[model samples]
Target chain A: MSVNARTMSDDELFYGHKACPGCGGALVVRQALKVLGKDAVAALPAGCMSATGFNFPQLAFANNAMITPFAATASVLSGIEAGLRAQGIKPDGCTVVGFAGDGGTADIGLQALSGAIDRNDDVLYFCYDNEAYMNTGIQRSSETPFGASTTTTPAGPSHPGCVTGKKDLFAMVAAQGIPYAATASIGYPNDLLKKVEKARDIRGTRFIHVMAPCPVGWGFPSSDTIALGKGIVDCGLWYLAEYEDGRFTLNRDPGRFASVADHLRSQSRYRALTDADIVTIEAHRDQVWQRLRQRCSCESS
Target chain B: MLEVIWHARGGQGAFTAARVLGAAASADPDTFALAFPTFGPERRGAPMRAYTKIAARPIGDRSASRRAAIVVYLDDTLFADGWEDELAEGGVVLLNSKVAHPDARVVTVDGSGLAADILGRAIPNTVFLGAIAALCDAVTLENVEEGIRATMPAKLHERNIAVVRAAYDLVAGRARADALPCCSEAAPIEGASGEKEREASSVVSAEPPARIIPQLQELTVAPERFARSTCFQGGHLVSKNAGWRSLRPLVDQQACTGCFNCYLLCPDGTIYKQPGAGSSSTVAIDYDFCKGCGICAKACPAHCIAMVEEGGGRDEALHIRQ
Candidate 1:
């Protein structure tokens, strides 16, 4: 049975500007803009999204777009909402989105974001988590998973790649008691679009964390970006899950997970990983699954 | 057709100079010019660079500025750090310096002092523009003046024109030198065979660290004036209401070579230097205390003094307005 495609909107929320070929963030943004339509006002930070979305006077977005500093997306969106309310010029059914990178969201903007969500601000916070800071020449961020090599955290004789585990932002946002929080991926465009549509209707903070692959930062061919994104899920390294009102749900499950080596072999970021490192990563994945299962049970109980 | 590399600190008018030069070149159809900055997050008081390419034919390589026919040092102190090496052999070097150069052909002007005299503040970019026009004869003083007017505000246009005239006259009457013989092309340095073999072996044998340690150093913090709890003072947070309040503009008169790098890199257009100011034509930052992003220090060629924390101040949080 053929599934019906969602009715696409003519309004370009993100104007067509140049990004690196096969940029996962760019593709995710395109899908997001498609879902958001004309009534949306995007507050982008100093990341790939901002650079690619606006090119001086000729912006890719058809609606109002504001490029903000790296870690101020939430504050900007809050101010925008307050301004509209103060002017008695309510946006015509507008969806206010604060888009940022993982570094901006999970690390730097976490406080402001937490405050905004706690205040129950009417904004959708989308974290396009490419793991590291790709714009600043591939620096390691808190969201960067263990074993991933960034420029600052190179696998040299003195040090390995990123030492820290990925920040559990979904749980952190859920802890704030915000209305909705979900993890999406570029590999699943339809699912991502649906989540965005759902979040648009919600009044309070709705968080969507998407795993976007960076070809330049991740040291992978542009053609392999999508494949690597999908491979992460297939290897059970990254999972698509959601938390809504204290309830946890795993959106997609891999019955039998592929080897961690399969995922690592595809990206250059993990080129330095040895056999022992692969085993350790596999064990970490198993532990994550256990935690996820426990959370799922707790939610039901 | 001449290519020029303008070196200045962030907040200097290096980019502005490049843009103005490009604009002047655009006025002449025979000359094709393109100006752009090297992409990075270089902030005020940091070393920043800009390139302007003017060619009789359409420029092929649209990348970083590798070869420059003319090297304009808005701040002369930048020259102490091998800034002259960027200049093509026999290319003109217009510097904002007090110490005269007798060895190589150099045009010296106190642009910062001239700008301060004209505009009541030290901004030497217009002066450098005039010097560039006079030295290269690539664009006329009229074109440079027009470009300045087009680039600057209406209120400051007249003063900028005055500064430009001062610089033009300073360099125009100087004796022109014949182009120096080009240097012999240096042979490519070959990699050591043993070193190359060792590098290959290391790559293959390298193992990921058993335990990765995350560096948890405090990242660069913004200045106190900009540091606010919420970016919600005015109805619109995007407005530059409190943006320029607590800037601590620093000018190292002893070190400033006055190349105008800072003036060009400033996104807010808030930097200016004066040639022949006080003791020297030193580069001066307008916003005394910058947001402390360090783009200027990184861009400064002179290894001059940088903006540091004045004292204990609350780190300002940047609030973005949607």
Candidate 2:
């Protein structure tokens, strides 16, 4: 059966942690774990998930889980997989996986992740991108998009927040010719679940970059996390795609993009962005999408 | 020395209020104040604490106060077990509750309602600041206003002062710290003083309101019993997180289609899917772990889930069926 809300397992692998209300990252971890199941050995780096999940005397993951150093997520996953296999104790259906945040994957831990993918390690990696270093008080990261205010990238009268574009992580990972790579969002759970299931079935290195909104960092109401996640994809600021066999497939075209301005204005992080700044962001998005449409197969997965 | 312990959720401005109170107390000559907050990895709506200490001499003790002369609860739901034990001899608990608490030592203020009226949102932090100005002789209303101006941004000064003033008047007019009066709605007191002023009034003589016993999901594991510092059972949450919610979602059985959208979308995994009578499956929320993010309600295509005020009532027993 296809992985979806109705067909998902009843057992909860992740629960009762200190993650914020409406935490999109938590949902990604939970849903992905549901797809991966009890045998999946998970490793999380020093991100929101590890900080919230690995409280002393209270472990949140129902399956075997451990925390890695801030920059050792992929390396640790490699080590775990190798150790399990060497000891001849690797479970039949067990899949070694790593869950890291935007900063942990795209910034501090990038080199280690690159090494893991280069070696074609038998592991699945998930980047729950909330677009910033949210756990450490909303610091700017490589994945933080333009015009989004963060502690380091303060928006002021003179300038817009985070002037740089978001790092194209999926493309970077796919550039190495990994077995599989996919882009997902917490707003569309079925798509994310499907990607996870696909990654689980694949043998070589697989990476899934999932956009997870942070209500606190984004300056939106807690209830709007999912809405904002969906809105970002609809507004063309984000896209859903998968890469395999030297081919890139656009899962969602979003033919007529939703209001970019409305989505930007909904989040206070973009409150300082003027109309001109928004125009610049929209222009960039359109240019990127045009290039993507020309290069990638615009067909649903 | 006067010490106050503030009970509030993470984002409720409890630390700000504590700092403002300290600033107010320190404004007085020869007085010193210290304020700090205690929190773990918990986020918004997670229960946490802040403390404020004021003394004539420099405060040497940086530890959390064991007992406080004043204990203020920004969210009344935090008024839980053993609250009375934290009080000093002349201590009082100033709670931001809509319903009147019968205990004379507990002064309930409709702070959330007042804040909603004044600021267009229910931020009850400053309301308690106002209440403290009336209840504590160490700090006056003028001091509080000055503190608000100093501690907060210029744009927020006027509104916070107004809130503080309104709260001060409400508490001062109704009850004093020494001679506490029952403010239950059952007995109506017309005047602030004179004929209405009595040692034991009709409201005081009336039956005390029943203690608010929240129907919380009981826990199977205790934090202490899990001896290992390394790990315990996976998904084993020793404590209930129900305290983190100010609102809760209820599903209307008749309208629910049981698409499992809510169960899938809940960030905390608090929503559960259960097999109903035959083929159809129903959903239920494990209130124990629910942080009340409202994702479930918003995701419901049927529009059956309603997010209601938390203490309005507990979720009805089990399975919101299709």
lDDT of 2 by residue, A1-301 (tens): 8888877777778878889999999999999988988889999999999999877545688788999999999999999999999999999989999999999999988998899999999999999999999999999999999999999999998889898989999989999999999999998888899899999999989999999999999999999999999999999999999999889999999879999999999999999999999999999999999978876898862
Task: Report, for every candidate in turn, its global Cα lDDT versus the true structure.
Answer: 0.67, 0.85
For model 1, the docking class works out as incorrect
Q: Candidate 1 chain A: worst 10 consecutive residues by lDDT?
A: A1-10
Poorest 10 consecutive residues of model 2 chain A by lDDT?
A54-63
lDDT (10s digit) by residue, model 1, range A120-223: 99999999989999877789988898888998888854455887899999989988788999998866655677788888777888999998888778887654
lDDT computed for candidate 1: 0.67
Chain A TM-score of prediction number 1: 0.93
Name model 1 segments beyond 4 Å from true. Answer: A1-6, A157-159, A297-301, B1-322
Question: What CA RMSD would candidate 2 show?
Answer: 22.3
Best by lDDT: 2
C-alpha TM-score for every candidate: 0.48, 0.63
Q: Which ten residues in a row have the lowest lDDT in candidate 2 chain B?
A: B182-191
